[model samples]
Target: MYGLMSILVHSIMYTKFITPLGIDASLNRFFEARAIDHVQVLAHEIDGRQERRQGLKEAAEYIKAQLERLKERAGSNFRIEIEENAVGGSFNMMFLGHGISFGYRNHTNILVRIVNSYF
Candidate 1:
């Protein structure tokens, strides 16, 4: 048989989403986590890898910590902007001739923008 590790991350994504590219490098630079230093600092690495309660919390904490670390390493070379919003709502719909109702409370959305001043 083969062996398995506790490493939670399986993938990484990088892109400049809606940013004006005017941030510092210290605020965006990370030591792996995604750059490959063996740290799992992404939401997708949630324990159990589920979008449910505890797992979600784990993922959120990981992301928060990573961002905090980046902030601590601040410099004028690059910049990073972070925003968090809590959204809750309910919806009712009919599916396959059945009535279904769903409501979510304290759903949080985190957005981060890494800007490179040079470009």
Candidate 2:
């Protein structure tokens, strides 16, 4: 039984885990639906027991660095937010427009998270 969840950063919107499938169509949809130009998976948790978990701090730092990279790429005029959804096992990267454009229409965002389980 594999569970997966989704998150939207600034608004803190989380989606229910669409379970029982190893193939995540939503993730594919998410990547394809947007003009993601640049995306880098910073933090990743391997499929293992919590007690055996390692690299958590490294993963976190990598994610933070990636967010900063994205911010730089988007320029100083763009506002970015990274929200971790540990409960949902996901993370949301949001971009708020501060110059040249405004609101949802102009700003772009991405949600990155993990899916893991064993039955």
Candidate 3:
């Protein structure tokens, strides 16, 4: 995903026909520098194990913080909503011999709304 984003940024920077609104050269540089930081934070903070529930919560918070930073930087009324739902009875091979047949976990759904008409 990070690679894809990097490719996309490069394409945008080089393409003559495509003009991203509110994204200048400086903002593009900012995103280029911070993109790896965002990925690193998510990878370290979000442990996708069923046993560690706090990791999911922390992941949601981290996403929120990143979105908030984006809103602040763009000076736009971008909105983010997170909806968490419980997923029950998920089967895992790791639990095969532990006598635990099923696992329950929470999944977070993130929605970002960019109010700009160009989007």
Candidate 4:
């Protein structure tokens, strides 16, 4: 798992344009410790399935916290913004033979957005 995470982080870093050269080093150090933590927190703690409204809210807060931490580390000029909006509810449905159907409604989603910033 560690190896996979390292590869994923490196791949992500490679895709972004590193500025000032020094930022690359800082980003490398930052992601080394935080990337896995972020993934675990989002994937495990933030359950987005049906009936998990609180979980969705918690996930949004978690993302905001992470962004704030990054902004603080990156310096005073860095800015982060978060927005929440209500989306139409969705239904999960499955149809079986003999005209049987099963479905459940899922609440709105919490959207997280990271503003323009240089890393």
Instruction: Tell me the spans in candidate 1 whose CA falls farther than 4 Å from its real position.
Output: 1-52, 91-99
lDDT of 2 at 56: 45
Candidate 2 has which clashing residue pairs, if any?
none
CA shift at 85, candidate 4, in angstroms?
2.0
Per-model TM-score versus the true fold: 0.48, 0.27, 0.47, 0.43
Candidate 1: lDDT of 6? Answer: 23
Question: Candidate 4: what lDDT?
Answer: 0.60
Q: How good is model 2 by TM-score?
A: 0.27
Give a tens-digit lDDT track for model 1, residues 10-78: 222343455333333343444323454224434345556433467766666667777777766767867
Whole-model lDDT values for every prediction: 0.61, 0.41, 0.64, 0.60
Model 2 bad stretches (over 4 Å): 1-52, 81-119
The digit string of per-residue lDDT tens for model 4 on 1-119 reads 99999999999988866443332456526544456668888898778734546786677677767666665665454465545565554345546634544443443444545454656
Q: Rank the candidates by lDDT, best first.
A: 3, 1, 4, 2
> What are the C-alpha RMSDs, in order, of all predicted structures?
13.4, 21.3, 10.1, 10.5
List pairs with backbone clashes in candidate 1. Answer: 23-78, 23-79, 23-115, 24-77, 24-78, 24-79, 25-77, 25-78
Please give the range of 10 consecutive residues that has the lowest summed lDDT in model 1. 1-10
| Leading candidate by lDDT | 3
TM-score of 1: 0.48
Candidate 2 has its poorest 10 consecutive residues by lDDT at 101-110
lDDT for 99 in candidate 4 is 50
